[model samples]
Target chain A: MEVEKKQQCSELLQLVIDGQATQQQRHELDEHLPKCECCRNEFELSLSIKEGLKSRLKKPNLPSELATSIQSKVLELA
Target chain B: MSVGESMPYKSKDKQRVFNKEFMPHIDAMYNFAYRLTLDEDDAKDLVQETYLKAFRFINSFEEGTNAKAWLFRILKNSFINNYRKVSKQPNKVDYQEVESYYNSESVDEKITTDLRVETVQHMIGDEITNALNSLDIDFRTVIILCDLEGFTYEEMAKILDIPIGTVRSRLHRARNLLKEKLVNYATSMGYKDKRK
Candidate 1:
């Protein structure tokens, strides 16, 4: 792939992965992916990373006592 | 719109508003604090300090608006001003510099090959968290705000006090850095052809 085309593909890869891409941009990437091996690899990489983040990085739970502590602390300041 | 401006500052009223608006977000605040500090004691102290500040400046907050965002701004500022001083790693990059660097040609070239998809394909949650924690504070903050907290780019920009474009670029860089860190794990796991 040409350098500029490769760059364009790279930009689209981020937007698509981030869920920030527009419909037209997604369409453009979908069209480009099949014909280009490099872009496909890049796209798959981006997708896996995003999925990994979402599935693995569970939200940290707050300790049971933390909320009451915060509440009392704030009230003390009042 | 301004908090406690229209309504008189009665103690009972303040408590009511505090309970309704501010208290519900404790989990989120705690999570954000813990991620930033990476220590339970420090995170608790940070949250306590954040609440103290928020209550002290409750009058400044706009009522019925994004209290979560407002509290986040305070928490982030407190982390930088107080925690960062005691902590070892201070943010060294001027965001303007990062923005300019991303605008440059090097970023485009770097992204093309920096992330090897096969390497991180099999990473588990703990490994991913480790990768995230390994990042610099700025990069990690973006990931936490966007990926972990599900803040919109606009919300992240406001919370982090950067422009929307900076949020996007920083998030992009953060993810790529994470991918680099997890590459070894993915490589060891062996890339399965799951795409078919």
Candidate 2:
């Protein structure tokens, strides 16, 4: 594939991975992926990256005392 | 007129409104602050400052609106204005330098040699977290806002006080930078793709 087409596919893959792709754009990507090995690999990699980010970055547990402290501080300012 | 000062008729009403509206979001606010500051004490202080500001300007907040987003916006602004001011070590990235390097031919060669996702696939949670935390604050902020906190691009724009287009671009760049960091980790682990 040409560099320009490859770049366009890359952008589309990002949109698809981010869940920002329009339905029509998604349909186009779906049609294109099977025909392009490079994009297919890139799409899979992007999916894995998204999954890794979402699952691995655990939310820090808010300390039990923190909530009450914040409440008191906020109320003190009230 | 400072907060908690007796406003006669409005004090009780404001307290009730403030507690009901803002208290529940303390955990979310703290988590966001923690991610941004990457320090427990700073996170706590940031949250305290955010709540104080929220209450101080409670009258400006329209009831029944998005309290969470409003608080997040205030926290973000406070971080920029206050936290960044006091911190001895600032994480400022020169975007022009990064962009020029990324667009250079040598960088293109380096990318082809350096980036391999197959090994990144095998990385564990701690490795991923470290890779993310290693990014510049601006990139990390976008990922934390969009991915971790699940803010929409529009919401992120409002919270970060950037254009929606900027939010999108930053998120894109952030994810790519993270991918690079993970790939570096994979390389250090001595994983090789025989198929390549």
Candidate 3:
């Protein structure tokens, strides 16, 4: 029974983190999280991991000439 | 016109759609391509091919729709058909192997418990990027789409041509694997596991 609840919390926690959870789902996680130490830790860790990925990674800009070159090639196809 | 049916736009309209709807997404497209190919030249070539294809098929696109998603679908398909054939890393793990491996293991407990928020917070950009790049392509892709690109599960399903359930499950498994990798990296770097 404990294992089953653990599995449910993980799935629910992810849905909450992803912003895909419904109001009910979010409320459910909020209630469950206080009682579950394992899930509370997992939730905090997952959020931090996601935050780190979004803020830390550098998104490379497109090469300067690549778009212009693609434009020219696309025109030639006409 | 319904999807898959050409709208027969005038030549000028085709060019307008190409510039107005598609050109704006070039940078995001390039970033996605680079991540998938992991090589600058190949990424450039793939983006170029995708743009040309997008132009040729502009008639199939509807104005004011999700232009980014459409462009992404084309780019993903082009990568599979073209770049995957010539990818230098030939040791690509089969998707079936990845599926079976994740299915056979209870990876959640192993990954989630050991890694701490402080350790992950201390990880630099290069460390995070390397960890992401080292994942199998399938796992890496889900993370890129969901976390970086911010695609919804339904949109991801259409883009990747998998069911929404598959997207959810794959994302769950991918995050677990990524956490496991981070845990391993932290342990190697002498970060103490307080649980031990």
Q: Write one digit per residue (lDDT tens) for candidate 1, span B1-196.
A: 2446554557887788888999999888998999999998889889988988888887777668888988998999999998887888855667677666555555444554555555565566888888888888999998888777777788888998888878887887676667667764454556544453
Give the C-alpha miss distance for residue B103 in model 3, angstroms: 6.2
lDDT of 3 by residue, A2-25 (tens): 666777787798889988999999
Tens-digit per-residue lDDT, B129-174, candidate 2: 8888788778888888777777777788888887887777667667
Off by over 4 Å in 3: B88-106, B194-196
Cα lDDT tens digits, model 3, B1-196, are: 1266656889888888889999999988999999899888989988999999888888788888888888889999999899787776446556576566545435666676788888899998888888888887777888988888888888888888889877887888788878988988898888987668
TM-scores for candidates 1 onward, in order: 0.82, 0.83, 0.92
Query: Can you list the residue pairs that collide in candidate 1?
Result: B119-B186
Which should have the higher DockQ, number 2 or number 3?
A: 3
Give the top-scoring candidate (lDDT).
3
Alpha carbon deviation, residue B3, candidate 2 (Å): 19
Worst 10 residues of 1 chain B by lDDT: B187-196
Docking quality of model 1: it rates as: medium
Model 2 chain A lowest lDDT segment of ten: A1-10
Q: Please give the clash total of every predicted structure, in order.
A: 1, 1, 0
